[model samples]
Target chain A: MTSRDVLFAAVGLITAAAAVLAVTNRRVLHAGLWLVVSLGGLAGCYLVLGAELVALVQLLVYVGAVVVLVLFALMLTRSGGGEVDTSPAHRWLAAGVGAGMTVLLGGALVAAYGWDTREVAGPGNEHIGEEIFGTWVWPFELLSLLLLAALVTAVAVATTGHSRDRAA
Target chain B: MDLPLAVEIILKAVVVLAAFLTLPLAIGQTEHKVMAHMQGRLGPMEAGPHGIAQLVADGIKFVQKEDVTPASADRWVFKLAPAVALIPYLVALAAIPWSAAWVAADVPASLLLVLAVTSVGVFGTLMAGWGSGNKYSLVGGMRAGAQLVSYELPMVLAAASVAMAAGSLSLTGIAQAWSWWWLIWQLPGALVFLVAAVAELQRVPFDSPLADSEVVFGPYTEYTGLRFAFFLLAEYAGIVVMSLLFTVLFLGGWSGPWSDTLGPLWTLLKAALVAILILWLRIAWPRVREDQLQRLAWLVLLPLALVQLALTGVGVVVWG
Candidate 1:
């Protein structure tokens, strides 16, 4: 394998390990941190694949925002001292299912694509803008609307009746 | 005779070394002098004119001081945290286009790369807070995380407006397109971006994580000596970077009144002006309450950014 391929494989291994750690880590906060590592590794994989935009979005959204919010929620819940039960029963069964699914998906991907090398097309930024605003404008707008709704919901949940609590 | 790769590497090394050594000192001196003036004092009149060497003295003191690690801290992550906090700010300088051809690496998505690297700086704060095993540090780190996340969206949205207006992700390309400058057309977006930038750097009014009275130095409460100095340097570097970026992306970059004549000097002048403003804000403002900070971001800035984005989109379609 080429050096790039080796790098990709290494990144994939790191990502998988981090994912496992995230799921199995005892501390909720530590697990959340591991989730950052896993997601960050996945972003690195995307970077290796030459998807800079996707990689950056992954870093920005997952590392910068989502995991942070998760940590905030963890802290706000006031469960800092509790021992988290990370281990789940039927671990062998779950691993078996995961391995099977991975194999099946890998088989489907290999069969469908057949090692056909395609040129990566023109500059990504222009293409992304065109794709986003031209053919996918409706969905793009819909996503924004949904995000607005989610923001409203978050604010409502965070602020409602808390103003009174502040004075108390 | 053709120069070897090593020679080029040496030249680049010299440039970076010069910058790393000199820029921080200059910026630090400027901050102290500005802070002194704002506080109605003479401000660092010794060590050199305007106390120019005050930062150097501070640096020496920091180096000579005792470096202590709290007993309760996680040794590995605690040690790693300050370096983590500082390195991203240095890496970010690589992507900031100083002039038309003066970028360290002219990557296709330089802006995004800078944002990604700087985002990792937050992890340093988070790890420092958590690993320190101090409640105050934990709270500080948590506050930093929340503030960074909330402000980041509005910051990204503000950047997107510029990207849409300029039709490029390259910082230099964006700067080159500023016939009228995006700041003039996207004033509201620029304002939102400035505020978010301050919050990202955890500066005044938004510096809840470091609120002395509230959190007692927050994440860095457990850090001492040079390790703590690194965090302070990183914060200042962040301010410098954010101001430079604001100059490059929106404020006509190096294109000033005398841009045709004074190329990089013009850019430096503009960036320095903005940096001065940031320093002034830092000294003049008081720390905002955490909840008020969040409310200002989500309730006010986010909607303003969204509107700015919408306006930019419409303007682009109509004018481009």
Candidate 2:
């Protein structure tokens, strides 16, 4: 394999390993931290693919913002104690869903591209910006509105909780 | 890579690392001496000729002191945290232009990459707090994480405005495209950037995470010797990086009267000016309440930055 292929393989492997660790880790905080590692590895994969803008956005959004949120939730709940859920009743269902998704996605991919090995040119920020604001403008705007609604709802819930506590 | 290109890259990395090591000493000493003078007191006059070698002495002392890990600490994460905190800034220096053609890495998405990588430093603080098994450290880390997250939004928005005007992510491109000094047209955005930058660096007034009086050095309470030194050095390095970024984004980076002849000297001078400005604010301002700090970042700065970004977009379209 070429050096680029090797790099991509390495990153993909790390991402997979970290993803497994994130899901299986006993400590909730450790799980969150592993999620950061997984996301970071995915960002590295993006970098290896030459999508530098996407890689950076992945780092900024996933590693920086989302992971921090996860960690914050863990800390605020005081749930860093290494207790883990040991229930296995849903294991088969989870496996079935996972397998179904894998098959569906793999089939879609194979049908669309027929196992082709062609390289796609890296879509830099300029092209991505055009796509987002031009053709995808409505969906992007709707996504932002959804985020704004979530934020407002969060604030409302917090304020109501505070008022309820004061009244009590 | 070709042999010469490989050699060049290695050489650039060495130069950046050397700067990372020494700049903190110089900037720290400058902060000490300048703050002393501002307060009409002598600062570090004894170490060697106005304490020029004081930081060197401190470095040696840190090296000699016992490296202590807390008894209950998580060993691996605690050990890895400092490198995580410091290495990103070192990598970031590669993308910063010292002069027109003097950048180590001139990638198209470099500025964004630098900001993204540096944000990962928050993980270091969080790791430090969590691994130390100290309640105070955990609280400190959480505060820092929240503060960083709040401040980053405004900073990114302000930078987005500058990127809109420049239409490129390369620092050199931004510097070259500024027909008028960006500080003139983008003053509100620049102010937002500077405030957010200061908070990002966790300097005075915004330093509740490491507030000695309150949280007992915040995330740093358990660290000792070389590890503590790493955190201290990382803070100063952050100041240097933020100053250079401000120079690149707001001030005309490496561009001044006769700057062509002066080369990187003008850039260094502007960076120094911003560094000194940071030190001035650090010494002058009293500590701000944590709530107030968050409110300023989210309530005051974020909207201002967003408005500036919109205005810059309009300006770019009309001017183009």
Q: Identify the leading candidate in terms of DockQ.
A: 2
Taking all chains together, each candidate's TM-score versus the true structure is 0.89, 0.96
In model 2 chain A, which range of ten residues has the least summed lDDT?
A73-82
Backbone N/Cα/C clashes per model: 0, 0
**Which candidate achieves the best lDDT against the true structure?**
2
For model 2, give the RMSD to the true fold.
1.7
Candidate 2 reaches a DockQ of: 0.77
* Model 1, span B98-126: residue lDDT tens: 78866666788888888878887898898
Q: Give the alpha carbon lDDT tens digit for every residue of A21-105 in model 2.
A: 9888888888888899999999999999988899999999899899987787676677864678866867677777878998999
Please give, for residues A50-158, the per-residue lDDT of candidate 1 as tens digits: 7788888798778877787777777667454346853456677788898999999999988998777554433476687788989999999999999999989988988
The list of candidate 2 runs beyond 4 A from truth reads B1-3
DockQ of each: 0.58, 0.77
Candidate 1: RMSD to truth: 3.2
Candidate 1, after superposition: displacement of residue B276 in Å? 0.6
